[model samples]
Target: MLNFKNIAIRRGNRLLFSKASFIIHKGQKIGLTGANGVGKSSFFALLRGELHSDEGEFSMPPNLEIAHVAQETPALDCTAIDYVLDGDRELRQLQQQLAAAEQAQDGLKQAELHGNLDHIGGYTAQARASRLLNGLGFSTAQEIHPVSSFSGGWRMRLNLAQALMCRSDVLLLDEPTNHLDLDAVIWLQDWLGRYPGTLLLISHDRDFLDAITDHIVHIEQNNAEIYTGNYSDFERMRAEKLSQQQSAFEKQQREIAHIQSFVDRFKAKASKAKQAQSRIKSLERMEIIAQAHVDSPFNFRFPAPKKLPNPLLKIEDADIGYGDKVVIKNASLSITPGDRIGLLGPNGAGKSSLIKVLSGQMRQLNGELHSAESLNIGYFAQHQLEQLRLDESPLWHLQKLDKQASEKDLRNFLGGFDFRGDKVNDPIGPFSGGEKARLVLALLVYQNPNLLLLDEPTNHLDLEMRHALSVALQEYEGALVVVSHDRHLLRSVTDQLLLVANGKLQVFDGDLDDYRLWLAENKKTGDEPAPAAIASPAVRKDERKLEAKRRNTLKPFMDAVKKSEALVDKLQQQQIELESKLADPSLYQEENKESLKTLLAEKSRIDNALHQAEDNWMVAEENLQQAEKSCIN
Candidate 1:
């Protein structure tokens, strides 16, 4: 168990939270949450022994194994799986010792070490690491690549995979889902639910926290308090506590009434069947959760668009991707003034590519894309954060958008996003990601665009800011297309779900829960196929027969593909184990010359087998793809 007795934490002279008293018992999953800069990371540092409390005492079991995702991943030549396997320090140590014993020709020592390895399940370590990689959205082909070959975001996933590989007593995860896609986030959520250890997670994703954590430690007003149950429960308890304050009660009532008004206005509209139902549900939730955010520093909304175009943009039989390489084929979509769409698919399935196409950041390779002359697009993506003029203040950024607007007006607008006082004039060069994201959002909201394209807009936002964004989106009059792993935001804001998978774009006739079930079924089939779009009555009979025939003809190819994949996986595991043994310096010693030769010979044979297995897998995959294409044609 871990205990914090009246703990006070300070960063420089700023006291983030004091008088934090809590006991995190073993095997309990705890969520650490607060506004950005409220020292949640500092709390994690304290747990990892990188920082000490300014006052009071903190205690934990001695020799406790703590695992955390590394902030940086070094560019190394080691294979990704090997990098993950390095997380199991004990297993690595045992392998090293066993190697030394083998070199010494000490049969007894070798036997004992082998027994220890088996006891700790070291023999299956590679398979375990592969599962972690696969679950995190790394393909089998990518797993064999060197670490240096990956981009920064992929490397962060490697770091997360490494952290998860450790069989530690306590796990500390800070925004583990930030670098993940929705599918990967769901996978990680399930994985954490099964983790047999104490988990301290700091995440801004409400649904993620609600799903994984049983307790919440919330920091506010220089105080840290623990609440039993998940994040939703914490919100309820905190709302009740805050309601006791008259000012908070007034704010809460206003917020509830505001949402109630929206509900009442739309609840009777037949045209808003889905959206009205969603808002009604949100209204019910706001009654319980609104008071919890009464003191939130953020409160902003998107201004009404200058023009409400019937169809802001339209795509007809379009192909979107980098030049000459189509990622999404024959896609068709129409965005009107009030369409709210959420894109869902596996990672690398071109959701962002489609967003880029719609935003005109990239041109569609084929077909027609029509946009109304009045269509003003407000596009938000992670890359846009870098596009912000770092040396400029929020006021300056806003001024660039509306040079005619007065300083006082711009300042008031910025204040809604929590940029007040000197912060409006201060250079944003040193601002946190969350602050920068808010500034970007502020700039976007100021434009009053008729179309909003948001790709993971909540990436760096905190719970309060996310809540604010969600509420603001509900009031937005423009069309919105969002790609986010935050299910709560998606549920709150998006009325339509679009599936981008298997090189196709189609409507998903289900909610997030249905998407979760679809993902499970897709995984079971080892194919990232999206649900078939609803067929017209005229074509349904023919399509059903064709689909059945396609399945029958594709079965042999799919079976062969799965078989080759299994073979490749088995050989890869063997290769990884052999490589681990070969990495020992003692293996090169002259005294163990014969043993080294035998190991080298075994390595050569395994390498040959692995290469053949990989070639066969490639052939099988090619055959499957060809068959799929043929069937489609």
Candidate 2:
């Protein structure tokens, strides 16, 4: 158990939180939330013993093993899988000792070290690390890739995998899902749900918090308060408290007004002067109740487009990808006025590819792409943040967009996004990622485009800003196509769901719940199957017949099994070749150490891939056998 007693913390003369008292019982999942610069990260630092509280005390069990994601990962010439496995310090130590024992030809010590390795599950460490990589959306081929080969976001994912690899009593994760897609986010949710440890998570994702956390620790007004419920429950409870506070404040204001009025009327009269003075004293002694502040700092809406085209954009039999590699093919889509679409798929499954094709950022490899003569597009992607003029202010950017607009008007518009006073004139170079994201959104919204194409727009947005964006999208009178990991935004804004998977684009007939089921099935099958479209009564009957048709139903499953088996066979053969090279005596020389390391890493990745492929094959075969039995019955 971790206990905090009247804790007070200050950073650079700014008191962040004071009188914070809370006890985190064993295995409690607490969602830590506050606005930016609210010391949430500082509290985490205090917990990790990197910083000490200015006053009060916090204590936890001395022997508890704490794990946290590293903020930075140095570029190292090591395989990603090996880096993840290194998280288990004890296992790495054992491996080191084992290697030395073998080098020394000490049979007894080698045998003892092997026993220790088995005891710690060191033999399966690579497989465990590989699973973590796969769950976080790394492809099989990428597992053996060098750590330095990945981009920053992928490096963050590697950091997350390393944290999860630790065997700890307490886990701390800050913005764990920022770089994940919807599918990977769902996978991480499941993984955290099964984690047998106390968790302190700091994230701006409301649905994610509600799904995984049982309690919320909110820091505001120099106080950290604990609430007994999920994020939704906490909101409800906080709203009620604030409502009561507002009522009390209003009643107190009425009394003060009455007292002041009486005092003004009686102060001129000698007889009532004493009574007025007594009332004044009473008024001074009464505690003033502050008004409730429920408003978000962000308040803005998308301006309606000037023109509404019947069909804003259309794609006919399009092939989308880069160079010669096709990510999605044979896709037909039509976007008209008032269309709201949310794309759903696993990472690298072509969600962004479709968006790129639609936005004209990437030309279609094949097919006809059409747009209205007067169509205007507002495209938002992560790279756009880097395109902003860092040396210029928000006001300058807005002025550049419209030279004739009044400065006061532009400042008012920027204030809606919380860029008030000096912030409006401050150079954007020092702005946080979230601020830059807000600025990009402000620019996009100001454009008033008939078609909005957004890719992961909520990546750095806070909860309040996300809410404002959702509200704005709900009121938007134009077509929208968005890809985001934020389920809350997707549920609130999107009216249609399009899935980008299996090199095809299709309308999903169901909601997010049904999408989850589809994802589970896809994971089991090792190949994505098209979801059945919404059916009429006659069509439903035909669908039943289709399922019962043994040959038709069993063929896909058999094919999947064969595909997985062939993949396993191919990987195993490569594994054999790598092992033969590794077995050569010359390969163990000092000059060949790097090559040996690469080969061993490849061998580990292949072993893990073969195991997964075999498991997939087994699942496919079992499903086929069950379908055949059903037909016979």
- The estimated TM-scores of all candidates read 0.90, 0.79
Give the whole-model CA lDDT for all candidates, comma-separated: 0.87, 0.81
lDDT of 2 by residue, 1-633 (tens): 999999999998899999999899999999998888788999999989999999999999988889999999999899998899988888999889978976896544654665576666665577689789989998656777899999999999999999999887999999999989999899999999999999999998988998999999998879899999888777766655765766554754654464355345434542332223443343332222111124468778788789998899999998888897777878899999988788998787689988988998889999999999989999999999999999999999999999999999999999999999999999999999999999999999888899999999998887778767875776688999999998877776676788887566887776777888898888886545567555578976875675556457677877876787688668766755654565466765688878867866776698698788766765765776565445433
lDDT of 1 by residue, 39-116 (tens): 899999999999999999999989999999999999999999899999999999999998899799775466567557
Model 1: lDDT equals: 0.87
**Clashing pairs counted in every model:** 0, 0
Off by over 4 Å in 2: 105-108, 245-293, 534-633
Candidate 2 scores a C-alpha RMSD against the true structure in Å of: 13.9
